[model samples]
Target: MILSGMATPTRRSVLALGLLGCALPGQAEEPIRILTEEYPPFNYTDKGKITGLGTEVVQAVLKEINLDAPFQSLPWARAYETAQSTENVLLYSLNRSKEREKLFKWVGQITPTDFYLFSLKSRNLHINSLEDAKSQNLQIGTVNQDIGEQFLASQGFAVGRNLQSSAKYELNYEKLKLGRVDLWVMNELGAYYMSRQAGDDPAVVLQKALRIPELSGGGNHMAFGLKTSDAVVERFRKGLETIKKNGVYDALQRKWL
Candidate 1:
């Protein structure tokens, strides 16, 4: 005869047993793969080492949990795709948006940045708003798979028509300088960084044509794969909160932003 409640485990106990089974020895946890791109002053390679504000913040968060994982800089598109498909993958400096909210488990915000449409100062182009810019039918240059491109696409801008997409932000800047594109869409800080890399003064070369404040205000975040467990996500989230409370977060921001 089968025993009833006397022999059968309760639902809570069964769940606890399952969780314990997952934690047993020989059930190793997967190492996290951190992915980033060459968005300088945030995440970039300096002499073969990935070090920047975002990278440091991620490293600090991981360190708090005694986890050490080096960031790998890949093309933004490739890195984005990898993070989408791979488990235990973390992507940083990713702009948070309503469109992307359900796709990944978010860790925390890393940096604040503003996006703008910039034209060469010499052109004296003036655009008061997105509609004004759109009316002009200007060719806007943006990096492929970038937040700028995503924003423009949401606004009904089509690539190969009015939007020129490049594999890199540097290439987009080059296209703007060469008159291949009428406006360059990028973050304000990134535009400045690219200008400095090209040995040009940002003030002298670029003028902000239109500011997209809605896209700018959300800042960027460290995102984990959708399959990542809540416990893992909370560990990083708590670590980030700890850093903010202890003042490491603000110090990094002051140094980078």
Candidate 2:
């Protein structure tokens, strides 16, 4: 009874139509762009590939959802801006702060770190607390836009006056070595790593400096752009939970720490 201009549907056509109807709706059409800065033991470029604890954890989470996203290492400020402006963007090893609480959709905590004020042993600097350091009126070296810098700024340390901000952590280390800055503010682990990278024995450097604990911002986290869909964020959150339950998260931490 089909018209000459109309094609007749067969059993095969009916089955094909049924299969198309079963396809999942609202599937993500694009891969997420993960961003990070060169913070060693967390996320950094090694042998032209992004590899680190945070990177590994993120990869595992994405794998659970059958998604693979490549990490792009950019300057901290640039990465922060890009994640703020772009949808489907992810950033990790990000410190959770009151000022940054509502800026992004947080996924889960990654790792814990302690910030400290390090001064050369030669200076014999004695600082038991933040108030003691402030009394000294020392020039503190910090990476631009880093959490340490933010914390100091919140404490009334002004840039170009008592705070010397550098775009690279290595530059801050250099400033510390040159005595351009009296105290270098950095993460405990990061200070050791940067000391090693600067061709100094990390243990020796640690022995030579005083590590006065300054800021302990609970922990770092993986976060997505605020505009990203809740569904996508949930997928990542579930994946993170799955990995943690399966002991993969602890394994990654052991490997790095």
Candidate 3:
């Protein structure tokens, strides 16, 4: 089911009073620091601005909860680490994996998505199974701490061996073409979106060599650092539910995907 992840305040005006009503009566509410990276149409930098479907949804959720958070984009690895190390932080479009279940407080899901091992169309690589890809000993480009990286690691793809990790998503895209990495794993939508961002047609530049079902279920979410109060997490969760019920969620999905 569609759920949560977050936004930039410059583009989104905070609502004076959300469903949480925390904006009223001179109450002091702790501000949340929302973080994400370049993984579109989930979230990405667009014309020097952080935006995408996830950004919009999180912005809407902030409005519902009477909360204001600054949306910041960092390299995937740094953002992941910051969210883990800092308190009162919200990270999104996060893949809700079993490996990460206890690391953070999950607010809710954002949207359903598929992950794939992608190869340049020109290479004509064939990977029918994870083992097939592993047997090839081909270098796979990935973003550090991304779900794609973590899943491949679980499958025995080790860094500096078969996995070549970069801090930025677009770097992996470049590595695929430069022949530095034989393949890259990313969300299906991001494959197309990133290709377009680089001014190439995904149909012409890339092909899905294998689909990783392990990365499919509960792929995107908004999660707070473990130290974040349960009360805050519940507030955001309720806010996400509010948007979904009010038809705001569907409108955003249609706009971005």
RMSD (CA, Å), each prediction: 5.9, 4.7, 11.6
Which residue pairs collide in model 3, if any? 3-109, 3-110, 4-109
Clashing pairs in 2: none
Q: Per-prediction TM-score, please?
A: 0.87, 0.84, 0.87
Which ranges of candidate 1 are over 4 A from the true structure? 1-28
Candidate with the larger TM-score of 1 and 2: 1
The CA-based lDDT of model 3 is what?
0.86
For model 3, residues 139-173, the per-residue Cα lDDT tens digits are 99988888888989998999899999898788899
Native-structure RMSD, model 2 = 4.7
lDDT of 1 by residue, 156-257 (tens): 898888899988788989999999999998889988998998999999999998898877878889999798888778878998999999999999989887
If ranked by lDDT, best first, what sequence of candidates would result? Answer: 1, 3, 2
Considering summed lDDT, which 10 consecutive residues are worst modelled in model 2?
206-215
What TM-score quantifies how close candidate 2 is to the native fold? 0.84
Backbone Cα, N, C clashes tallied per candidate: 0, 0, 3
Selected candidate, larger lDDT, 1 vs 2:
1
lDDT of 2 by residue, 190-232 (tens): 7787788778976665533444344565778999878888888
